[model samples]
Target: MQGKKFGTFAGVFTPSILTILGVIMYMRLGWVVGNAGLIGAIMIIVLAHVIAISTGLSVSSVATDKKIGAGGVYYILSRSMGIPIGGSIGIALYIGTALSIALYLIGFAESFNGYFGFGLTINDIRLTGTIALLTLTCLALISTSVAIKAQFFILAAIIISIVAIFFGNSNFQPETIQLFSSVDAVPLEVVFAIFFPAVTGFTAGIAMSGDLKDPKESIPKGTLLAIGTGLIIYIGVAVFLAFNVSSEVLRTDYNILMKIALFAPAVLAGIWGATLSSALGGILGGPRILQAMSIDNVTPKIFRKGRGKNNEPVNALFLVFVIAEAGILVGELDVIARVVSMFYLTAYGFINISYFLESWANPDFQPSFKIKSWIGLLGFMACFAVMFKLDMLAMLGAFAIIAGLYIWLQRKEVRLQSNDVWQSVWENVVNKGLKKIDANIDENLNWNPNIILFSGESKHQSYLLELGKTVSGRTGIVTNFKLILDKKNNKPLKKVDQIVRDDTFAELGIFARQVKVDNIYNGITNIATTYGFSGVEPNTIMMGWPKGLENSTEYSKMTETLLHLDYNLLYLDFDRKKKFGKYQTVDFWWRETDSKNAEMMLNIARFIIASPNWNKTKIRVLFVNNNNVNQEIISSKIRELVEDLRVLVDIEIINNAVEQKPFYTIIEEYSEKTDLTVVGIPNYKIEKQAEFVLKTNHLFETIGSTLLVKAANNFNVLDLDFIEIK
Candidate 1:
């Protein structure tokens, strides 16, 4: 049962034709012709169809190129514009379609009230409309085929009525066609508003895109054919009304078709059938849109379920029925018609804009059916022009609703399968920028750190990424790399591991990779040197503190080699569990004047303080008492240095004796109150292995989380001349 699907005629043309030749044709076309005259009415039809046909061309071009699934216009727009804009417009279209059901039902009720209610109340008319809405909704729930088959009978009644009116006329008076209404000439824009909706039901077919067997082939053919057919019918009706009816009668009676028909009964039947068929079309199309949005997770997930053996969207159909019945209570057909028109026109405008942007900016948007970009632009402009003239406040309200929905959906972060068109747009922009940068690649005053961070294992490394992002400012590249020593396996990165690592890095919006090699040192050296673009190569290497002194020699060797290659090194020993207290302090230890690490540490702390998490972090400069050094002189020098640098920090003089206790204990005691500490690595010396081992162990045991730095002296020291006594 699920295998059966709708082809072009039953799925697309039938609904499109039924909706286009609906209540407006039988009930309102004569009124439009009466007010606007023959030429003005024709102009209105042509302008409305121009927007419809142009939008159809764009829809066709995109439909032919991709496998368009459910969501119809929503699918097309979302796939082209991304989920946020697409979802918002889809919601508006859904509401429009829902209201369309109500509009058709009220039209049916009004005609029913007029024909059968000589002595009945308006409430009775509402009951009949309610009954009709329920019957059609049940048919829609049972099968789309049921409602579609009902349209055949409706179509037959309409044809007989049209034949009676056109051929049954004895005389065609061409001179009776007035340029303006005999009573009062309605504005051309107002007439266009009333007439424009006639051309819009063509998209009702597109709403059933999910049920069609081949939407790509059916949507374009059936939609365009419907538009062309509606245009011809409207033109013929406008001409017939102009010549056959007196301008005074046309202006006075909106139901002039019934009064002039050879068989008044058949004409009455045509009005009822046209209204019912259009209601059927809405019932059939609106639910499918809700179902598609549900499937895409834009709507609630429960709506994704269907009850029928053929997977008909019965739940969504019920939802549409409830909304239509509510609309039946209001029961004002003309006002409902105008409100529905605003939503439809806005949707049409967005559809054209999506296609225009695709054609102009996205090189990947290759469609088999090509449409000129200007047609889309023109269609988009025309839709808004007519919309504002119809009702400015209503149009603004509709736009506000769509924009609000877009903001809400963006915050929800709904994910879809379509590729982001923004990526292609950005790619083109960046390509042009790169070409411009090639000519002046070596200009001075451009400094960005392309970093290669050594991630030993993938556990608890989120802070590493945070620091990388903090320093890079999202302008430079930071790659988290893991090196495996076993080289035998061809694909050393396990799928599960890659997925876990990717998910971790994706949260921080960073890049991560793993490389397997015979030696870890060789892997690090190779990747760091050859990782990034020329003139933007990896200028920095960052690593966490080593586990013990056992790997110090190898690490020192790596540092020397990296420094020789003009790369700066940063070593961090921070714990992820630490939280910032009310009084946040960053302790910086100055070892000597030659330690360029002083400048690098201060710069990094400044970056940290700029972040929201560490916004109030205070910096404190600390130094141990040296041989015969005066504490007052040192404290005064630190003050002078802080004043010169124009930064706020505390100057601490530590009096702990290094000979009495381990250097780690003294440093830890002095820095116990601080949140994070900054220390510099002493210059590498091959003759002092024991001393290096002792210092490495003691420093790693400092009170708080610490950062170890070894600057390559690639930058000048901060000016300290003011700190020197005059």
Candidate 2:
């Protein structure tokens, strides 16, 4: 279902009625008490209009490019400057909303007391405030349609009251004209104080920008209309009060509007009706800002979720209500007005600054109504001028809140940018490089053994048995087995695999364990790279050498590629033994070469020695000598490096002169007892020897285990996962 947009007239009327009727009465009461002259009143009204116009322009400009969410000001600002700035604005907006809520509750309580003619205690006011807040919250939660409907109804009441107030003042005598001429009679401070409330409703208009269907057209028009309407009403009411009610009576009574309303029987109803309508607007508008802020990620996302039916930020609304009700419990009407005024002034000043900077920063973003940048500059100056009138604590508190928000946004932006930079580098360089290398090395092999089994159909079951045997003693491996099925073709195999899982567990019986199975549609390489990055490093990989296919070029290439992977690639050859004995003998074939190459050999040997499975085995080091004069020197150097091994190390220095296929002779001698053979080559390239090693195929067909290491002069063993002799 689509949401209803704010109509043109409503867009203007809501803010207009909210601004004038909401707090103008309270402002006037303060002014009457302060005795601010005509000039002070005029200054306040002019300053307010300037502020209204500036805010309207800035807000409308933002609204034109983006959808205004419930997080009103914060959302618009955040969209303009990005999240960090948006967050600061959001927090400030929330604080302002909270303060406004509190102020309204205070006003509600004071007005209730004045009308009821009772000596209501703070607790009584608090109770009524809580009930009123809860009612508003309930209304907010119902639906946006309902809320807007309520807004329209309240605005109607406000308009009716304003009209009545204007009509009631038609009987103004000559004394009223004389009162206007006696401008010096009222003190300048009092008039300024009274006029401040007249401007309070401007923000209420600004807050409605999010809901307006055509904020660009409606917001500026509505804001100006609201301001104009508010001005007329405030001036009319103020003049009527000044003439009808005596200065002494108005001075002593803060509810001078209510008293003057009594003079004309119908005017009292309008005054009370306006008060209620204003309170309703305050309650309705404040939560939307909070919700918008949350949606922008400036606040918790939970608050942004809002109610499904209402599309309202119920959590934010409820929070506002609670805070406002609490403020009502502790504050009087004066404190509420002061705190609210202080917050609005500070926020409004920033609004002007934001607009000014935005205008200067992006001159292309011209508004429909372009006040000279100096107007905003002067508007901010005027805001600060009136801000000094606030108490020291209120001023400090307001600035402190804004300062905290700025610091928070700065920190947030730094972290956000740092994360973005890191992600870009990883994606553009690290991930890209690894993927390219992987693609070149083995496009067919699935390095990841976590999900997809690496071997073809004939070897799958045997490989599974080998995996089960390998992890027999390890408890941690029980739940880690993953069986990946090809989604496109393995529907039957998936069911069979599930059965295999059950049968395997049944066979294990008491050792019955858990295994994970995933059905995937992609090829092996994609699966491998995906899991490799996902942190699933398989301990052992098992596969089968195809019968009568071992000598095939394809088989050789596959074996060579698998060897390069550096994992324990156990080939389930039918000719090989299926099980291991208690003690195993391993052969370590070392060649005398440069000190650096020798170190690489030693590091590989040490890695084997540290292995839990291989450390207990006896290791034989066969140092082949091609009658090089420096053979002893190289042997001695290797001996020095291998001195720390606890296992028995046998070093055989075979003379190169008597060699009849050196690798063949060595393997024939050691193949009977050796479980594994590790060989090392000379660091420097020997062209004749290299060709012989590559073409002869002398040791290539050997049945026993063999590893041919092509040593480089400056090799770091730690960097190479596996050495490939290609």
Candidate 3:
């Protein structure tokens, strides 16, 4: 089954014109002239239309380049600004359009009562509005084509109304023009609020974008035409009413259109047509917006259920009808108008902002029709300025509504893939930050770690990644390097292996990479020094403790190369088969009493505790008093250091092991129960090479996981020299 597609004239222009020549034009334009006069009303029309035109331009620019599906403004916005913003605007626009139905219905009911119900009560007006609402809604539900065809007759009636006004009014006296309402003489902002919706009706056509055969072409053409036509009509009405209608007649009698008409019945017909058409436009367009939003998962998908034979959004139409009837029952047309205006203005402001970002910042936003950045900026500023001036409470409420929707959608995390406007903004911000960092590269206090870790297969890779993340705290890039020795000639490692490794690391919230090289030693040396941007190169290299290092010289050569490059090297050894307990325990063994290892180990443990998995982990600052020299003094020293560093840890003095016992034996006996053990590797001279390797081998051979940390000159930790340990 194929859905009906509409062209520019029937799809865009007719609906747009009918909605534009709406209740505001017939009912409020004269009142606007009575208050703001010819010049003020013209200013209001021009200003409002400027926003509309700019938004139309922005819409056109974006629509032309992409195949706009459903969702209209929501679709365009979400696709351009990501789901959160788009969903927010979509919901606001939907409600605004839905409210418009009641707004128009009430206007029609008022005019109809004025013409026929000479002395009717408020109930009569509500009854009439309800009937009209149901009537138009039925027309809309029947099919969009039926509703659109009905707009043609409404269009004729509107033209006839305009003609009747021009021919019938003979009281032209430019000098007797009223500059303010004789009854109240309201503020300019209030008057602007009344007249602004006249131009906003163009979005009704925009909301029907999904049904349009060529939204890219139709939206720009039909929208601009409707805006231009509406502007002409409003300006003419302002001029006509200013020179002709008395200030008393304009202010006291809101139904000034019927009084000035050549045939009052034709004026009533025009009023009914305008209101009904506008109501129909809202009914037809509002549901489509909701349907599109639903399809995109911005709203409940149940709304996406009811597409009639003609592809009319049947479910969405019903939803819009219910809301509109509720508004009719309220019968507070003025308040609804202000709220509807506020939401439309807010939507326009975001549209302008989206365009401004696209034109000025986003390189991907290459539109066929170019819009100046200043135009979008001016539109954005004008919208909020007018909104706040018109009704600060309503403006704030509208923003609150949008904000609430934004937060809700963000929480939902609706995943839709598109190059959003924010991505460009973020990229520019990142570029600026990188440049600033590059310029301040020489400052030691400004240095942040950029770490590269040598990873093995999936099983061993996670350990290295976790430790790297612990040290880097995710602020710095932690790249997992897998160097595969090309033992089989021209037979590369399966790409799936690299993919699996990358995915596993990603699940742990880390980045990973695999490189096939002839040698792991040379690969590590080359990759570490040249892994990142100039100022952001890997300052630290992390790896799991190498197995059988006594049989290979790779570790010694790599350590020398790393030291020469001024990079801090850290190696971790952990029992992969072991499952850690709640409140993970970390044992930081202060072997050398040097600040380098003390700072590095403390920093790593600090980061680990920050993780949810290890948030309550207790740090044991174990002081091994092998010589049995002042155990109380050493415990006191560790306590002061822990307190000075502002870390919560228990100070333990290892008195069970004597100087004759191996350090590994002491570690195995004391720290085997803990989740992690941290020991600082002493800076080994060339003569103490065998001793250094032996110590590393013994530590790696321990039952618990161990981190062997060696800090460079760049690593900054708290100074213990100033603290007086009693």
- Which candidate number would show the highest lDDT if scored against the true structure? 3
For model 3, the run of ten residues with the poorest summed lDDT: 717-726
Encode model 2's per-residue lDDT on 1-726: one tens digit a residue: 646677657754564565466645643543443253334444555655666566655555545544455555655555555565556656666666666666665556666666677547777777776776777667766765675576676666555655555444323232432233244455555556556666666556556666667766776677667767766765656655555555555545565443333243344444444555555566667777777766555667776666563475677777777666666667665665565667777766666665655555553455665566665566667677777764667777767766788788677653222121123333556555666755565323322223223434343354334333432332212222233454454333333443343565445321222223243212322333333442234333344333454344544444444335433333333224522333266566654343333443454455455556655877676666554435466456446556743324766566563453565566666554455555554332232433444432445354344444443323333221111211
lDDT of 3: 0.77
Residue by residue across 1-726, what tens digits does model 3's lDDT show?
A: 767788888888888888888777777787778777667778888888888888877777777766788778888889888999999989988998888788878777877777675445678878998888888887777777888888888889889988998878645344577654445677777788777777887777888888888788898888888888887888888887878877656655677777778987777788788888888888988988899899888888889876655567888888998899888888877776777889889888888888888877687777777767788888889889888888999998888999999999999999787778788988887888888878877734533567787767665666667667766764767777768788552765576666434466777666677767767788798787677785566788888777666445676777788888888777877677663434478888876445766766666766777777778788888766555556677767667766655678888777643456666777888887778788777677655666777767766565577777787887665443322433
Root-mean-square deviation of each candidate, in angstroms?
7.1, 15.6, 5.9
Estimate, for each residue in 1-726, the C-alpha lDDT of model 1 and write its tens digit: 664678888888878888888877887898888888888888888988999998888787778777788778988888888888888888888888888888887778778877776334667767888989988887876667777778888878988988878865534354556766444677777777777778888888888887889888999998898888888988998888888886666667777787778888888898888788888987877777788888888999877788765567778888888888888877665666666788899989988887777887788888877889888888889889878888998898888889899999999898877775666767777777667656566523333557788867645577666777665544767788877688675666665574235676787667788767776777778876677764455777887766564446665666557777877677777655563234378888874453466666655655666666667877888766543356787678767755654567788877543455544566677776677777777676644645665676566554656777776556446443223432
What TM-score does structure 2 among the candidates reach? 0.52
Task: Give the candidates in order of lDDT, highest first.
Answer: 3, 1, 2
The RMSD (Cα, Å) of candidate 3 is 5.9
Better of 2 and 3 by TM-score: 3
